[model samples]
Structure formats: structure tokens, C-alpha cells
Target: MIIRREHAGDRPEILAVVKAAFPEPVEAKLLRELFASREYIPELSLVAESDRGEILGHVITTRGWIGAEKSLGLGPIAVQPEYQNQGVGSALMNATIEQANKMGESTLVLLGSTDYYPRFGFVPADSMGITSPDPSWGSHFMALPLAAHKPGLHGQFKYSEPFNAL
Candidate 1:
């Protein structure tokens, strides 16, 4: 399998993979909204494709803010149920992180599994002075500072508008 940027044609398959990966429909709905959102960063939306051309997983990062400063919010990453534990999700994540760094992004934040994300260098956002929009998120709210990260980036993290709508 290989990781690559998502294309417009991949939407349907991507949504299928996301829906199959999670029990709730909220994530799939969010993904649809993100695609049309102004905050959408095409380069940061990626897919993991099987050798046979099946989309095995998907991930997206959108424009977010830390106080008034620009940042990124990652979410709704999903690997097909059959693809779980096979590194498809990890590949998509590494590709997104690498691409974001190339774009000079400061940090990538997400609310995710404490066990799964730390391997990619993510830590509690509060540890870096970045507060979550929902304080109850606590440690599940994490951040991974990129190569362009700066010490001054701190304050309430506001996700893209669609996220606010949710």
C-alpha cells in the first residue's frame, strides 16, 4: 500500500472507509463538511491506497487557530475495519505530518487515543501551553509541534467553523 494526497474522485470511497471504521456517523459528516470548508487544506488531506487501488484509510487536517495565531487541527482519520492494525492509518498520519512540515506548519493538534498517537510524538496540548477548546478533553487533546513550531504559540485552540457547528 502507498500513501498519497486525496483526489476529488476519492470522496465516495473515502467516506465509505470512514463510516466502516467508526460506529458513529458524526465523523463521516464532519469529513463531508471539511471538504467544502474554506479551512480545508488539500495538501493535508490524504489517503492510504491498497495496491489494488482501494482506499484503505483517510486523514485530514484543517486550518485552526491558537488564540489569534494559525495552526492545524487533525481529525476524522479512519482506516477501514479490515485494515486496522496493518499500518495504513500510520502511513496516512506520517504522510500528513511530513506534508504539513513541508508547508511550514507550526503544529498539528488532535483529540485522539493516548496510546496510538504518542508514537508519532504527540503529547498533551496543555503541556505545551496550548489549551483545548473543551477543557474536559484533557489528555485526549494532544499536539505535535512541527519543525516550524515556535515557543510563543499558546492559547485556546479554535477548530475550523464546521467543527464549531458540530
Candidate 2:
């Protein structure tokens, strides 16, 4: 398996995987909105592929705010039904995360399963004094400060307009 930046041509396959991974329309709709929005940075989007060139999973990073501070947000990481639990999600995540670090991002935020995210270094957003616009999420919203010595961000996150479209 391999992980790499997704090209424009890969959108269809990426969406297919999202549909298979999550049957709900919400995640798929979010994917489309993010792709069409100005906040979408192609370089930060990634996919997992097999050695045979089959697209197996995807992950997207988009512009989001922590209070007034700007940072990246990871979401909608999906693997095809047949590929679930095969580390495809992890591969895509590690790749995009490494890229964000290389690009000097201050942090990465996510809203994910509380049980799954900690393996990737995510701590409860509330613990970091970070809050999301939706209070119902409680501890499910999370953040990981990427840069050492970087002052922590503490404020309500403003997700990109595309997120609102969902």
C-alpha cells in the first residue's frame, strides 16, 4: 500500500470510497463542498492506494480557524468497505499529517471518534482550551499542536464555509 497527494482526476474514485466507507450522505456532501470551496488546498488532500494503483482510501485537510488563529483540519478519512481496518486510513492520515508539519502548520484539528483519534496523538479539544461552534460535540472534537514551542491555540473554531454547507 502507498499514500500520496490526490490529483484532480482522482475525485470520482475518492468519492466512491467515501460512499462505501460511510453510506450516509453527510460525509459525501462534505467532500464535494470542500473540493469546490476556495478553502480546499489540493496539496493537503491525500489518498491511499495499493501497489496495483487501486485507490483504496482518502483524507482531506482544509482551512479552519482556532479563534483568530488559522490551522488545518483533517476529516472524512474513508476506506472502501472491503478495505476497512486495513490501515488505509492510518496511511492517509500519516501522509497528510507529515505534509502539514513540513509546511509549518501550527496545529491540526479534527472531529472524530474519541476512541480512535488518540492513537494519532489527538487530545480532547476542550483540554487544550479549544472549543468548536457546536457544543454538543463535547469531547469528540480534538486538536494536536504540531510545532514544538508553538503557543497553544485557545478559542472557538470556525470551520470553513464548505463545512456549513453540509
For model 2, the superposed segments whose C-alpha errors exceed 4 Å read none
Give me the candidate number with maximum lDDT.
Answer: 1
* Candidate 2: Cα lDDT at 107: 80
**C-alpha lDDT (0 to 100) for residue 112 of candidate 2:** 91
* C-alpha-based local distance difference test score of model 2: 0.85
Q: Give the TM-score of candidate 2.
A: 0.95
Pairs of residues at least 3 apart in sequence or in different chains that clash in candidate 1: none
What lDDT does the true structure give each of the candidates?
Answer: 0.94, 0.85
Q: Write the per-residue lDDT of candidate 1 for residues 1-166, one digit (tens) a residue.
A: 9888899899999999999998999999999999999999989999998899999999999999999899999998999998799888889889999999999999999999999999999999999999999989989999999999998888999999989977
lDDT at 145 for candidate 1? Answer: 98
**Which window of ten consecutive residues has the lowest lDDT sum in model 1?**
82-91
Which residue pairs clash in candidate 2?
A: none
* RMSD (Cα, Å) of model 1: 0.6
